[model samples]
Target: MKQRAITGLFFIIVMIGSNLLGSYVFSVFYLLLSLFCLLEFYKLVKQGGMQPERFTGALAGVTLFFFFAANCYFPAYKYIILLPILLSFIPIGELYKKSEAPFTNIGFTYLGLLMAVVPFMFFHAMAFTRGDGVFNFHVPLGFLIMLWSNDTGAYLVGSKFGRNKLFERHSPKKSWEGFIGGILICAFAAYILSNFYTEYNRFDWIIMSLIISNFGTMGDLVESMFKRSLNVKDSGGILPGHGGLLDRFDGLLMAAPIVYAYLYLISN
Candidate 1:
């Protein structure tokens, strides 16, 4: 418990600090995060008795992230062409290796990009969604706060009041009571965030919280399902108590894209 608390506090500090530092720091920080998570995902895929193109896939994921980051920061330059060219190496490299399940390997390689890289891309894009080409940290910071609130709220509330299971098949510990707790707490966090970050109205923040809580739970369940399928408990041991990058950001994995869409729609 001590270790978990320390690690959680450190995670919060680093995340909040990166957002407060400005766009370059935020982009560079999350780009490295995206790489780490992608590699960790490929590691898990390898543990499942299949060989994915780890290096090539990692390169592709990095390229994909850079492609987006470049667009966000330097829209005048065309880094778009580099992504496809780098991605082409995946299948080409597979042909030389001659693995028994080449297509399966290819599928998982791409799956890592979709599951790990794309979500971060959406998240990174959110930092620069304003029409004036300015990078505001309000959306991202509010997201982290609400997300952490939901996770913390669910854990505290569900541990005591939770009775009925939410999804016993994938995650037995999760409960509907916890789910409601998460929603309420997330909404409250959003309400609090609105007072500080007035870029979005209070109602919009509430809506964003709803999107985060519901889809964030789904994200947790999805990661649980994924780990169960692999017969593994945690994604990795990088964090002392948080399991892995995937475990820590599972909520963001699913929630980021949806929240991004919501912010985009309302902003436009």
Candidate 2:
């Protein structure tokens, strides 16, 4: 319990530091983290008996994210059009490799890109999403704040009053009691955040909070399903008590893109 709390606090500090530092730090931090997560996904896929071209796959995912970052930060950079060319390495590299399921490998490689890399890229999208095309820390910061609040509330509430299983198959610890508690707490946090980060106003913040809370639970379950298939307890040992980067960001994977789309549609 102590280890989990310490690790969770350090995680929050790093995220806060990245957001407070500015766009460059935030971009570099998330990009590198995305690459590490891509590598971990490939490792798990390999453990499932399909051989992924790890180097090419990871490189492709990283390059795709970098391409997106450059495009968002500097619009003219979009003309570079190098992402497609870079992604070609996946299948071309597979030509020399020996795998019984070449297409399966390619599919999972792209799945890693879609599931993990793309979501992180969407997080970047949130920063520069305003019509003015300037970075805003509050938007992304609000997301992290809400997500953490949901997790904390769920753990505390579920541990105390949980009686019904949320999804006993994929995650035995989860409960409907926990999920409802998390959503309510997140909505309350959204109200507080509205007082400070008022660009979205109080109503919008609560709506976004509800979206994140519900989908974030789904994302956690999705990752749990992945690990259950692989018969592993944790994604990786990178974070001492928190598991791996993948484990940590599972909720973000499910929440960020949907929230980004919602934010875009409403704002624009």
Candidate 3:
């Protein structure tokens, strides 16, 4: 318990510091982290007895990362979307040659890319577009704070008063009490932050908070499903108490795109 707490604090500090730095640096860091995560995911796929082309998959993953980075840094790069379609054939070819269940490999690989890379691109895009500093630091940091508030609230409340399960099969430890607590805390954070923003109204920020918190929880569950399927405890041992990069950003993975879309749709 003591180790976990210390690890958690250290993780938070590093994350907060990185987010404060802004978009280009954040995107660069994201690209590198995503590469590591992609490596871990590919390792999992290989372990599942699927013969996915590792080099091809890694290349495709890196391509996907840059494509997303382009989506943020250069919106005019419409050709970026086509990259996925083109690379989709690599997995498809592997699926075609399989004597057994080829589709599973192809599907898992594709889904992994979507689950891991696409939303992160959206996050990068959001970070770049929303702020006006060296790296558009404020938007990403605000988003992180919102996510952290939700996570902290859920942990504190769920540990104390949780009884009803949110989804026992996927995440046995989470409860409805914790879920609501997290949402309320996130909503409060949103309200508080809204006062500083002239662009979004109180209701808008609150809605964004709810979307982030709820989907973030679901995202964590989704990652849990992957880990459970692989029969592993944590995704990786990158963070001391936090498990892997994937484990730390599972919520952000889903929440980032949602927040980006919210800003894109409503604010724009």
The numbered model that scores best in TM-score is: 1
Q: Could you tell me which 10 consecutive residues in candidate 3 have the lowest summed lDDT?
A: 129-138
Candidate 3, pairs of clashing residues:
23-135
lDDT of 1 by residue, 135-170 (tens): 999999889999999998899889999999999999
Q: Which candidate number has the best lDDT? A: 1
Instruction: Report clashes for each candidate as comma-separated counts.
Output: 0, 0, 1
Residue-level lDDT of model 3, residues 24-92, one tens digit each, is 667788787777777777777677677655666667777878876755655536776767686777666
Greater-lDDT candidate between 1 and 3: 1
Clashing pairs in 2: none
Question: How many residue pairs clash in model 2?
Answer: 0
Assess candidate 1 and give its TM-score to the true structure.
0.97
Alpha-carbon lDDT, every model: 0.91, 0.88, 0.77
Model 2 RMSD in Å is: 1.4
Q: Compute the lDDT of residue 172 as modeled in candidate 2.
A: 98
TM of each candidate vs. truth: 0.97, 0.96, 0.87
